[model samples]
Target: MSLTAAADPMLPEPFGILRKRRELSDTFTLELEPLGGHRKFAFRPGQFNMLYVFGVGEIPISISGDPDDDGPLVHTIRAVGTVSDALRTMEPGGAVGVRGPFGSAWPVESAEGRDVVLVTGGVGLAPMRPVIYHVLTNRQRYGKVVILYGARTPEDVLFRKQLEQWRSRFDLFVDVSVDRATGRWRGRVGVVTKLIERAGFDPHDAVAFVCGPEVMMRFSVQALNERGVADERIYLSMERNMKCAVGFCGHCQFGGQFVCKDGPVFRFDAIRDIFSVWEV
Candidate 1:
């Protein structure tokens, strides 16, 4: 086996960028393949990896590629900080270091036979893409599949082409809205939570996955609760400030849980008490 396969989980394996696509002005999607031909980075939907950019720094980014695809690992990132900015400017052949596929995943398998509702905003859609891919692949195993996405404006919409393709499918329901309309945009204008009421899924029989800014998630949870989805059936991705992919670093600690190890993806009921608390 390759050293990467046998190495410590904390050791970042070398990888080379295979392709990079500009999704928005500040956001880019990178496709990475292991160097020295290590095994493909296998991970379930919603897991994140710590990406190290040589002398720059490291950041946790969600794996956006389909788990079933025999393709390179993918991460959709926005240039919000130094390390990510360096990654944004990198070319296809640029090198990077990856240390995980870590954290708990969305409970896609457990949600089988129930309606699946995905609510995400801005760049947050990246982590939810894999779940969409899984649902589409095993379409018959689930009931209604609803996707509700919101962006700041039309230009801020990530994965427009992919969203259009998903919308084209008769088996799924995709609705996108913007906080404001620019140019000739004629889509719905509102926060993502507003779309929850009109979504096709039966709230009581649904499993909802939410991600985005914490504020958005808070409101989304409120809306889901009002719509009758149980807290146990609602999940959230708290992808924030994780300096280390392993539990050794306490940067991602929230309440009694460490997001890097115990979560990043958590059931709402499990953290409901602290979920609404400010600056935990």
Candidate 2:
């Protein structure tokens, strides 16, 4: 209906920046809406979009907005490189080109009737936010939702207010920890994996989704295994050097898989040995 063929999926669509809010000093969220009223870009919880900043460049960024929020598409970006820094400077009404909502997603639908454990570190929470949104939207579909987040420091936390609100909900559980604390900060101080022991969930009935630095994800798998969760039940969002958000480019190759096409989200058991190799 949109007059685009799946084969030629590289065309970037026009979008208008509707709003922006700084979540942390270096990271912010951009709210964008389709230009010319194109059919809303629909996607599952863990998908990503290739965002192009006019003349600067493009990069693969996860869609952080709620899947049910029909108002605008949201992306949380940190000012790390040239393109992202350029994007961070954009104001309301800015124009951008978006080319995706690609890659494999977290097994949200399959987690129905079972407990879901989501763990993220640093700005990695952006990709995991949609899963939290999905479960909260369909509260009765899943058994329990456990969220564990860790940041570099107290001031490094992203989505602070939203995290508080989720914690306030009686239906879900949220545990946030900081790697280090500054003045007056007294929350849990350690890596996110340490928070797993305190999280309430049934290993036998639970599915895990982890995203963060490679080290964090690697250790998270060990922690989940220690907690008795099966390998196939643990999913991870892998981050690699990705020049192209689609499979055409080989920049995101990890072992025999291409992160852009095969996954950004993968079952841990499926790729455990591949990623575990020291040379890999």
Residue-level lDDT tens digits of model 2 in 167-275: 9999989999999989888889999999998799999889999999999988999999999999999999988888777777888888999999889999987798798
TM-score of each prediction: 0.97, 0.96
Score each candidate by Cα lDDT: 0.93, 0.91
Native-to-model Cα distance after best TM-score fit, residue 258 in candidate 1, in Å: 0.3
The per-prediction CA RMSD against the true structure, in angstroms, equals 2.3, 2.4
User: Count of backbone clashes for each model?
Assistant: 0, 0
Candidate 1 runs further than 4 Å off: 1-7
Model 1 TM: 0.97
Query: What lDDT score is found at residue 132 in candidate 1?
Result: 94
